[model samples]
Structures are given as C-alpha cells and as structure tokens.
Target: MSTNARQQLQHHLRNARYEVLPLRGTLEQVQGLPPGTTVTVTSSPSKGTEATLDLAARLRGSGMHVVPHLAARLVRDSAHLDELLSRIEALGLTEVFVIAGDADNPAGRFTDALSLLRGMEEIGNRPHRVGITGYPEPHSFISDQMTIQATDEKARYADYIVSQICYDPNTIASWVKTMRARGVTLPVYIGAPGSIDPSKLLRISMKIGLGQSMRFLRKQHGVVGKLLTRYTPENLFDELSPYLVNPDYNIAGCHLFTFNEIAKTRQWAMETADRLQEVPA
Candidate 1:
C-alpha cells in the first residue's frame, strides 16, 4: 500500500471503516456496537429490497452510520424503487451500496444495476454517497467489457465504488489501475476479507456469490487455499499499504467483508490501529 493509502486506512480505523454485513442476524449485533462504528447492510434477491429499509432503521436507531445495500436485482419496478427511497429518507440513511445481487436469474423487473440507478434518478432521490461494485478478477458470468461498461455507467450515478474482495493484492492493484486507465473516476473502497477463519471465509464466500472466489480457490488446486486456512487479511493489507499512501490513485479506504463476525472483526481493526500507531513515526 502507498503511504497515502496507509494514512487513509489509519483515518478509517479511527472511525471504524468496516462494511458489508450480509451474514445472517449480524444487523442486530452490529447495530448495538459502540459509537463511531460503520456497518454496511446487503440486500439479496431472496430477501428483497425491504431488508435494506428494515435493517437501516434498526441500525440508525442504535446511533451508527448505517449503509444499506440497495440490490438492483431484487426491485420489482420503478414504483418499488420509489418506496425504497422513501423508506431510506424516513430512516435518514445517506449512503447506499448498489450492486447486481446474486440471483440465479433476474428476480423481478430488474436484472442489473443500471436500471436501479436510472430509477433512483427518475424518483429524484440522491443519497450523499452511492457506491457500486468492481470486479478485480474476471466475473464468472460477466465479460471484462461488460464489467467495465457497467462500472463506467454506474460511475455517472455513483459517488464511489467498493470492489469485490480479492485475495491477491497484486490483482486488486492492477484492477484499480485498469479502471483509472479506462476513465472510471469514482473513488474506490477496496474490499478485503476480515479476520475470519479461512474455512469459514471460503464457505461464506461460496454462500454469498463465489463469482470468482470459487474459481480462484479451485484453480489453486489446494496449496494456496490450505495456507489460507490460517490466513487473514494481513498479507492483503501489506499489498495495499503502499496504495493507501498515494492520492493520485484515489484509493479512499477499506470495505471489510466481515461475513458477520463483527465482534472479532472490530477487535482486529482496533488492534491493528493500535499497532499502526505504535510503529515508528
């Protein structure tokens, strides 16, 4: 990671920049977390967009910055999009992570993110920060051109991006550069897995989407995944540290996919912050 990215990480640590709690029942656990914590919620096709409203309300009531994921794949129509926006307004949520959710097929009238972005505009709802997802590795179901196109178009509607969780820092770095080269300018929040056990993380990854994760692990044929069994994000951080220090890269902060281990994940961040502070100034 660059020094700028490292500094950004430190700042994020000061404010608890954790994200993406799609795991079951983590909403309540994260909502009750101490002050200044950041919790992001995810919406899936099976659960529908209503999940964002319910969870955002629960988290806001607990006095935390709650970011709700507005999955485009689950919305039924334009009016349905309006309802989700109204609920977000009533709940005072200013940020949302928009993505094409994991659905075997389009769940409703919408199948992709552009539809939701257009719908958000038609309804005149603009959250303070809107985020989209980027694929560091090839998406199993999407071509590189389609992925880049989706990002380019989404950038017009989004303020920033939260990339897919990538095990390799080199790949993440390369993807960011490729995006920049492609003229996608939204600031990026690089996704990293938290301090969960590798086995559990792998399982959770598959459970969620595994778009590229299963492919990566399967291609590894065993050695890498075995080593990763004890591995956490320490190595990934080492790869990103330099970029965190570079402003031109527009690296922003982190999006930790806690996989619902909020307690342990938060502890890991706090401890990491302390360790960073203790390092030579």
Candidate 2:
C-alpha cells in the first residue's frame, strides 16, 4: 500500500474486496494492511472457529471493514450464535459472510448455511451486510440441482452472492443470467484468484483441498500434465472484463481469492487496472 502506483490504482476500484487466508502468519500479514480495506476471512471450522473470531475482532480494531466467515456448521446453537454475534456487534462489526463450511461433521446441530442464517436471525443478530456463496460450475460435493437449490436458499437470506472461483467468464455470465432468470436476485461478485507463482499456486491449491479443480486438472490427461498447468484464475477475469464494465449484468465488484498472496495479488490487480485504463473501454 506504500507504493505510489498502488495508491493511484485504488482510485479506480470503486468496489473491491480482499479475501484473506485464516492461517496464523497470513492473518498477521493482513492486519498490517491499510485501514478501511474490506477484508473477508475464510470460515473453516476445521481451521478452528476461535481463530476466525479472534482475527475478526483484531481486524475491526484496526479500522478495517472486517468480515468473518461464519461457518454455520460450527455454531453450537442459537445461544452460541447469539454470543458470537454479540461479540462482533460489540466490536462495531457490521458484515459477515456465511458459508456451508468444510466441516464434514457438525460441531453442533446447525449443519448448513441456511440453518446458520436462520439462527442468526432468530437471535436478532441481523448484520448490515451478508454474503452467500454461488457456484458457477457444478459443485464437487452436490449435484447441480442441489447446488442451485442451496444457492436459492442462501439468496433468500443473503445480501449478495460471491460465485466460486471459476476460470471461464462465459460460464459465469451464463450462470449469472440463469440465476437472475430463476428469481435469485442476489447481486453477483465474480471471484478470481489474484497474482501468484505457478508452483506455489499449485502447492497452495493442493493444500486447500481443491477437490473439483483437481478433478478437472486430472481429467485433462495428456494435456500439459505438469504442475504448471494447475490453475490461475486471472484468465477468467480477462475474459469477463467486458461484463465487468457493463452495469446490466448485476455484477457488483471484484472479490479476489488471495490464497494468502496479498502483496502479489494487489500488485497484479493494480497493474491490470492500469493497463485497462490505457485501453479504450
């Protein structure tokens, strides 16, 4: 954030948010980021619920717009959720992103995102903003029909939908249209990975247990099987640049999956913004 180029680049970003990894070291890194920056914390109870909450409080203290991922499955019950929300509200937090967290087994009775959202509502912890996940492609765990159903339910309770990291803009555009046509009106935030090294990218991808993407990569058998062929979602954004500049698509803003590569991702996004401004819209 100290670079002059980055300070200038931020002016063009009317709406953009950073998704930070919830690990210990990475958490400290994001803490040092510029204030008022909206930072979304990944919610993985498997990663530990206490850590997410602690980080959120810490970020809020830094005057940044801190958003904690409230993994619904981890909440013990309405009482437990109320306590959590009370803590956040105490810190002046106004936003939260809810997800069907990766916990295979429930730490409590709440098992899905809807259950969690409902619990939050019942406990009078309605946040100023709430976000739900949307999958442009078929879900790795559930059928397409089920994914759509889950999305619809989430939409009913969420303020917006942040689509999963997809590498195809056409796929995302089609999915957005389909979602709107189906009456799921939550504005969409198309997610893409920020800048990252190819080797480290694949290593981190594997570390995150990217089941669907790995399946896709493996199926690309004989087609550049090297790890370099892993994935970098910037290509998807390049294709979607047209839609991004269009207002009718209900495209909200950028949601970068940093993969804990904050500095590199910020650099890449600013450079792209600079390049885009140079070209005719």
Number of the top candidate by lDDT?
1
Looking at model 2, how many pairs of residues clash? 0
TM-score of each: 0.89, 0.85
Residue 73 shift from truth in candidate 2, angstroms:
1.3
Q: Per-model C-alpha lDDT, please?
A: 0.75, 0.74
Alpha-carbon error at 111 in model 2, in Å? 0.7
Local accuracy of candidate 1 as per-residue lDDT tens digits, 210-250: 55555555565555467567666766776678877766578
Q: After superposing candidate 1 on the true structure, give the runs of residues whose Cα lies further than 4 Å from its correct spot.
A: 1-6, 20-28, 205-222
lDDT of 2 by residue, 20-132 (tens): 87787876677546788888988775677778878788878788898888888788878888888888788788999998788888879889898888887777778899999
Tell me how far the alpha carbon of residue 258 in candidate 1 is from the true structure, in angstroms, after superposition: 0.9
lDDT of 1 at 159: 93
